[model samples]
Target: MTTEASGTSPLNHPEPAARTLRYSAFTHDPAGGNPAGVVLDASRLDEAAMLALAAEVGYSETAFVTGADEQARRFRVRYFSPLAEVAFCGHATVALAVALAERLGPGEIVLDTPAGEIPVATRVDDEGAVLATLTSVPTRSRPASDTELDATLAALGWSRGDLDPELPPHVAFGGNDHLVLAAASRTRLAKLDYDFEGLAEVMRRYGWTTVHLVWRESPELFHARDPFPVGGVVEDPATGAAAAAFGGYLRAVGLVTSPARISVRQGEDMGRPGDLLIDVDPHGTRTRVTGGAVPIAEAGGPRRS
Candidate 1:
């Protein structure tokens, strides 16, 4: 296996260095959300270098802005997990948008990601906080295969009896694919003790980025937990991609009556609580996720072992 250092020599060289910024996404408090590493200018770095930086950052995922068109406020963004590159990441995208908004002033920004083009709108709140809303690519959801569902439940130590019959298991996609498993109760969702390797294998086979474990509190309120074994993380504090996908799932399954705005409370079980706002249009194909991010005080540097 190639080590991170051997994969990229840019970190050792002096010229054309990249600057990384750390931000906690989906929350105004730096300590209350998912932290993501954002490289504002990564045009000089190759895939190997980006991967190395992501691994060094030790975050579930990192956002790299490789190319930018200043006049149009457009950028080419890539996402890297600690273990591999992902097609898209919701929290990282929101973090990158807020990071850019802080510098360029809040407005609309277009991001070209591996999955597709995503348009993000940023605005300053009454409290002087920058919030970003990203419209995802067209979303779709389908019932999970019996084999995959059974295997995933076994890996999670959950049984069919533990599932909420109203919200059936599904494979949902907004920008990336996720397995949506709605637990019968908040207690069932709280007790998350899954076999990491087992879940990772299942996720890899299905090309799923995360397993969205959720419990509905009401028509518009929910609590969610995401198992991101594929990213080498046991759980994600905040998951925007999964939230958008879940919106699509709710609409697809007829759980939602009309165009609705849903609020997802996540990370509470892990003690790093965050909130995500999701908007589903009755006539639109895509879902929009909104959240706020704050910059972490720590300067970006080499990863400490």
Candidate 2:
């Protein structure tokens, strides 16, 4: 596999470096969705190597494909943040799925993540972008304890009055845990100044991957903003894992009808608008998050290793 970088040949790059591909997930535009790094063949890279590469890429998370069974379309995917390994990263998963679809053709691919087994379906759109939908692990949610709510609110500089009365705060789990806090208005959701260290401390203590901050625009429309200080990101433009968790939160709290499909608009405040389509099944606990991803401009085209 050869990807010609400017002023250099990929042949000279050894191992995982030559296999890295960058993409933005949850949007067809590069300037939209959250950027992610994908290493299609990381068979030779150790945990240290992966972490270093992730820091160098500086994306919210980088997905590394450590093992694969080509004929069965099954692979083991690991996600790494700049600072540490993440249990699961939905945006990176989508990015990797689309990148693989471009080379291996649109189809279903199974990923074994640290969180659980994930099945992603990919298809090419009319605009020539590969759209991917990932079925999250079993989702669940529970009301946040008073202590938890108080700590998070203190860190976020938000009070109970600022929260939506209809959607109560909860701890939701998709592949990982997330604190679901619904802002009373879009204005409240947009202004995102918070104590990063304080929030990170709270998140770490609670084992939360992100604070799934959201505002309900309508029965089916919503605006979301995710503060991912724990991941070493000030903000995440598009967060598929959190979106999936929020879906479970919504359904659990009776905010949406079962067998619902809702649209989540995120990253708009950051100028990188991304849209996620979440489908929550009435009978099943798993949620499906759908979106398209685009190759980062500098990567040029399809790459493989």
Candidate 3:
């Protein structure tokens, strides 16, 4: 299998596809959480090949493990959505970390992503569960422009009154930009039939990864649902990128004081319940997202031809 990495065009495309792995991120059960595709040995694959395999996996995003520094335990990783390559993907990162831990013996791995350098730490718990935590790139949040907010609302079929007065509309970035909309009532967040093409257009215009719909149940607990039309998925069961972004948004909006640990419950509405733990530092720009992932035994999510 000749590849661009060796200054040659790839002749056998199926070699790369057979190496893909399928895992569900943010949950220990394969049936729960967001499904992610990981290619641990994607060093031989190019961008176009990665994108094609990601589409074939039919997941929101896939993480390709590329260049590596074995001495430093650092690796170059790339994220590709079904439609295009993205800067970063949090759930996919978690899934990749756990998958790598199984082979690398689980301690710490640094990932060089397009967004920035990400540090992931993996630990085996007392119950023999592998937990992976990813520290996001510097995160920031800003109030959404009125025009942007209006268009998003229109696409979501939501009016101004449906929004929470306290949690105003904002664009938050953990690794990618996500539109954070706080619903005043949990009921409003439950029913989420939206205009797919309309939202995808708006997201592409604003460079948004997903629309993060949230409802605060308590100070340290929240419920979340993500609309990922831009990724060619109707909804992402669990969104680690948005959760990291939300931690930044909470601190920016005075919703939480510094150095807070909160839990975001997601995928429940979709019957694939997963929980993401977000830790915000008092002085650091990075937010930490923690979750567990398990491989799918039945389907590997790659079409080898």
Candidate 4:
């Protein structure tokens, strides 16, 4: 069951599977950006079943709609990586929102996740594509310990000199925790070769969902890459949670003025380029991440163990 990417890994547990939809988030094209599995209705599934289904789907993460309030357009959603459950996932959230908008009509929806209540707004673009904007929960960030930062750099084969001294390294949290490391140059960020096992160990120990590797291209433009070993993925193409966390990191370090919109370009090195738009409000603590999603395919079958 294990692939060459990881040795001797366990397969997804066998379970009665539910119908799942596949979509690519953060890109208008179905072939671009990050792909996510969305279970529009998962009320009948339990946590173990959800986890198994997520592994079967084999995406970076899958989103499950556990509860729904049709009258208010509110839902209880849960996110599960292949290996375990995550508090929240931005791209999946966007995908789900767009999916729902297509059915329920573009508007606002409330998602109650383990992390907190997230407000998502949906709109139809001029081209008739559904776009979603998710406002993250209150965010906070703090400096990473010197020891932890050093170990992480070693795992990524990065050094202090390669880092953007002004940005530094910090553990930032939007809904999920991510270690934010700003590279001094785009070239440094592009050449990503990390010890998967080592980085995974460090992330698990620190409760980090991903390592947000970023390089500022301009005052409001950035290039980002996320190492998501904790999710059993080599990298994430468009990480909304990490982008939100990075927005928080920028605010924490006084790198960005408030009420600003930032653009993040990701997945180019991996050959699936995508764009994520982040909005920071000077009056609010939450950051908003916006993107579009398109259906890729549909799947429904029992997962083999």
Across residues 3-68, which tens digit of lDDT does each residue of candidate 4 receive?
Answer: 111212111112123568888899997767888998877777899999999998988989998877
RMSD of each: 5.7, 5.3, 4.6, 8.1
Model 2 segments more than 4 A misplaced = 1-18, 299-305
Give TM per candidate: 0.92, 0.92, 0.92, 0.91
How many clashes in each candidate?
Answer: 0, 0, 0, 0
Query: Which lDDT tens digits does candidate 1 get at residues 177-255?
Result: 9999999999999999999999999999999999999999998899999999888788889999999899899889988
* Candidate 3: worst-modelled 10 consecutive residues by lDDT: 2-11
* lDDT for each residue of candidate 3 in 1-305, tens digit (9 for 90 to 100): 21134322121133343387888999998989888988866876888899999988888889997776654678788999788899999999999889878766789999999999999999998888789999999899999999999999999999999998989899999999999999999999998988989999999999999999999999899999999888888888899999989989988888776688999999888888999999998577889999999998766331221
Predictions in order: lDDT: 0.89, 0.87, 0.86, 0.87
| Model 1 per-residue lDDT at 235 | 89
- Give the C-alpha miss distance for residue 278 in model 2, angstroms: 0.4
Please, what are the lDDT tens digits per residue for candidate 2 over residues 131-196?
999999999999999999999999999989999998999999999899999999888998889999
lDDT rank order:
1, 4, 2, 3
Residue 62 Cα positional deviation in candidate 4, in Å, after optimal superposition: 0.4
Off by over 4 Å in 1: 1-17, 299-305
Best by lDDT: 1
Return the lDDT, model 4, position 233.
Answer: 87
Q: How accurate is candidate 4 locally (lDDT)?
A: 0.87
